[model samples]
Target: MPDTLRLVTFNIAHGRGLSLYQKFSSPERIRKNLRAIGELMVKVDADIVAMQEVDEDSHWNWNINLLKEIQAVAGYEYAELGVNNRRTGKRPLAYGNAILSRHRLEHWHTQSFGEATLGEKGFLYAEIDYKGQVVPLLNAHLDFRSRKRRVEQVESIMDYIIENAHRGPDERPLAPIICGDFNSRSKPQADAVNHLFQHILKHREYHLYPRDKRTFPAHLPSKTIDFVFLPEPYRMTRCEVLPGFLSDHKPVLLEFEL
Candidate 1:
């Protein structure tokens, strides 16, 4: 029998729940929002979850570890945070992408696109052992404003994968499973998501999920800016854009067997 897994990628807007910004919300409000997000995570029941714009020990969010709060409620045994933005002073702020999993995560690493103290973007890479099979996974958040920068960030991601995710061909059988807030459309040959998808196809065939699902502005979505990319061997069993106003962006859930 093959093992099956569920995964979700969501940009949580730092747990503000449709608020304009974190600064406008109080610490208690942020915590309340996060608890609701945790409840959603439980309802989804994903084996591995990718999250963007997660905060930690930031004055704006009342020095709360957002991931921990979610994990506390959802009860995930393993979690890792890739802090892409870090600044310390009278008013400290730190946040980035993160992953929570039911399986053990190993050899995890984080890479940022730039050195900006805030609004920086990046990805987290890790190799997970599932039922004795080694699967490489990445959780990323790319630039949302500039198309050129998003493409550049994709290039960096590809380069990193080529350099780090290799062992002997016989030992490494599966390509990495990537999920994130790409901030670009899946159409148009020139788009960042397609660019990365096309580039990886040079080596092995891959599939992009929720191709027609619009995930942004959860209450009234009109664009698809989040996705999950998996190699051909992993057969997708189910895919759905979850409904809710958990954040500005909706969560995409994908179920697969390997």
Candidate 2:
């Protein structure tokens, strides 16, 4: 194993390209768009990829398993989908956050903010085994519309971390490397990103990367809603926003030393 780990967190807009609505895209077109994203992943050569808004058997995306499509080209050894929303029948739907890793993923868990099967946001937690090292990772997507809800969601995630910290299957579970589309800005004093970072600071120093790099609205980004919160023992070597039009939100990459 190398001294550093490279990871990328991206919201692929359900593999619908830059379109505002996924319903307008044909199944084949969506597949092609997703393959292009996979190509980007190959170029980035990240050890682990965390994704939000990925689909699996979703009607809007033509019932395509978006993770498999990406893995087909990206070629990760292990892939797991954490479905936060799932609806069946005429308008079937299933989509959420996912992780693709070159290492093994174990003890996977998923949670949703609400019981509603559509448009619900949540997170995925997993313990990844890289050689003999065990790393705890959380891939999250908070409420995009409400500040209060985003804060509440952050609280829930913190609680989850506290509850699992000691009882985890791993003998030595490192502090989580939390990454994803937080949906809340890092400014104005009360945003979810700052809120989560402050909570983590109680125990040890945590670093939030790509400090001022805007990621949303890829073409003309106004604010950054994507980030990686890495705790102590893992030092950030480099963090940057990658250029791409694969999704409405550009991907953020983090290279860190464990």
Candidate 3:
């Protein structure tokens, strides 16, 4: 109902922080980390939060459903979980993306990029009812290992958007918002980031948040991999990188007007 919408994109790193290589951590540690992250979310009070590397009933985080905990702590009424990677056995492990929203999330959909070099990754698409406006929202996590794979993933996402969100050339439909950890480094020679940026520019009237801050390695961040892209009719009022090491990547918060 308000004039502006605040959204955040975070990679929780399964609540492991800097110790990402470890198989698992003590229950106490994980709980503490989750609590801290929840408190941060409450403080930020974002209308929607797109998360990456979230665990669902996984042993790595002591079988805790991180998404539920986050939703509860952040006081979000709606949520959608997209499991991109799952291991089936006695103790099944599932990992993927999640979107926690204060608004109603309708017609939610998920798609996987079908076997990349590193692992399976995908995006979560949904339409949020924001003050009577239907806003198409996308939360995505691309392949982290291969640049070529990431480019393909970006192309796939662009195609999905065109098929579902595009309203034609004449109609000025509400431009969709895409947010996530693109995993595209900030270096000038980072072809993946350039390719993805150019691809969006070519396909749609898109605008990206200025790369003025770093998000990864949260404690002493140095890379601007996470991003928020807004197309025409949806302009950002403000953008900030929240300071925290709750996850390996700091949350990027964007306030936009529709």
Ranking by TM-score: 1, 2, 3
Candidate 2: tens digits of C-alpha lDDT, residues 142-250: 9888889899999999999887863335554457989999998887569799899899888667888878799999989998999999988888888989997999999
> lDDT tens string, model 3, 6-125?
889998888786776425678778777888887887897799889988888776677788888877777899998988878767657787889998999867888888843225889988
TM-score of each: 0.96, 0.96, 0.91
Q: Write the per-residue lDDT of candidate 1 for residues 1-258, one digit (tens) a residue.
A: 778899999999998889988878898898898998888888878888899999987887778899999999899998999999999999988999999988888679999999999889999998877866777889999998999999999999999988887463586545799999999989967879999999999877899999788999788999998999988788999999999887999999999998
- Comparison by TM-score, 1 against 2, better one: 1
Poorly placed runs, candidate 3 (over 4 Å):
115-118, 166-174, 186-190
Any idea what lDDT model 3 has?
0.80
Task: Identify the runs in model 1 with alpha carbons over 4 angstroms from their true place.
Answer: 166-169
Note each model's CA RMSD in angstroms: 1.3, 1.8, 2.5
lDDT of 2 at 88: 93
Instruction: List the global CA lDDT of all models.
Output: 0.89, 0.90, 0.80
